[model samples]
Target: MKHYLPQVRFWKIISIILALTGVLFTLIGIFCTEGALAVHWGSDGTPNGFAGKIVLVLIALMGVLSMFSGESFRKERPGWHIPVGPEMGYALSTGLTGCCAGVNVIVVLYYFRPDERIPAVGAIAIIVLYLMFIMIAFYRDRRYNGRDVKTGEESHR
Candidate 1:
């Protein structure tokens, strides 16, 4: 497990960086905008609801909390049902954090550009790409750590 430290650290750093970026963008949007920020969007690429600027602050806090949670990947916890190792945890954390950051950026974009709207397909594509990245990271990490991807067991080699 010691060998997995570097990889874990890398993901943790990436998660933090992305989270911080999201927070910064949110703060900027909150301060620069005059009215409530768009919170919910309809499938037709229109925001049907709005939220106070404080919501952006809460979102920023969630981003920070998520970065902290990603630290759990550094070590194993007792009695955990999922047999995820540290490397896999870190990779998954990065994926989740990346998604949150994407959402934050989109929110900020909505604030800055009220006339524009993000297509639902674009959002779905972003999610799919992040999921693919997470899967690829897990596969590569498992190969590097000498584990069988299908069984999640150590390889004889």
Candidate 2:
């Protein structure tokens, strides 16, 4: 557990940094909007509808929730199973980071005009970044579990 503490702390810090960035972006968007920010886009790559800047607030909220969720899942849990277990910290770390990343990208796209949709390539890039983050978290989890603290031997458990 002690050996894993530093790694867990690092993940938490990453989450916090992303969350704060999202919040800052949201605040800027809020101030830049006149009446309401464009929150919906049409299939033709144009803004078709509008909503309050609360949408940005929601994105910021998701960021903060992700930071807490990632921290909560960084600990050991004996009851969790393999695929969705504590040993697989990928879901929390990768999901939160990906979500925050996506939100940040969206905020950037709309921050100035509030009516622009993200380019298709930007969306694809976010997905690829998410997959990469998942792989990283998976590798970290495996490395963290390489040794069994109780048995003091190579851990297969």
Candidate 3:
């Protein structure tokens, strides 16, 4: 259980880093770009005028929320039972923070482009990365569960 504290701390740190990264990227986009950042493009690749800096603001806000959510997991009681224990709680909180922040980071990169168009592959890659984070968290949860069972220790305690 003591060793697990390090793992939990690591995830919390990662959450903080991700949130900061998202916020920084959004700030860069906000300052470097002009009015009406491209939010959407038409079939013909023309700007639909639906895109705006507001998207960046929304994404950044999500990033901030993600950071706080992860921190809350550290201090708050686990409201749900699916995660089962601290290990899973840390994993879920950290993974969610990373995924949300990653989205903002991706969008900032895409929107900051000179042409204001995001490469399809870049967008897809963000999704893939998020899935990878989920897998890692799941794996960690299983490992912690197994360890507790093998050691005859109660996971909740």
The best candidate in terms of lDDT? 1
Candidate 2 residue pairs that clash: none
- Provide the lowest-lDDT 10-residue window in model 1: 1-10
Candidate 1 displacement at residue 147 in angstroms: 5.9
- How many clashing pairs in candidate 1? 0
Q: List the residue pairs that clash in candidate 3.
A: 39-51
Model 1, position 86, has a per-residue lDDT of 60
**What C-alpha lDDT do the candidate models reach, one value each?**
0.69, 0.61, 0.60
- Give TM-scores for every candidate, taking all chains together and pairing residue i with residue i: 0.73, 0.67, 0.63
- lDDT per residue, candidate 3, 1-157, as tens digits? 2232224665677777876777787788778877766555566555575457778778777766655454345464556434335554555565665666666565566555534345354456667766765666666666666545345555674
**How much is the lDDT of residue 19 in candidate 1?**
79
Task: Decide which is better by TM-score, 1 or 3.
Answer: 1
**What lDDT score goes with residue 40 in model 3?**
52
* Model 1, span 59-123: residue lDDT tens: 77776666555447555567656666666666666666666667777777777775544535447
lDDT of 3 at 110: 55
> Number of clashes in every candidate structure?
0, 0, 1
Taking the tens digit of each residue's C-alpha lDDT, what string does model 2 give over 17-99?
A: 66677788777777765676655566776767677778778877876766555435645568843354443463465466557
**Cα miss at 25, model 1 (Å)?**
0.8
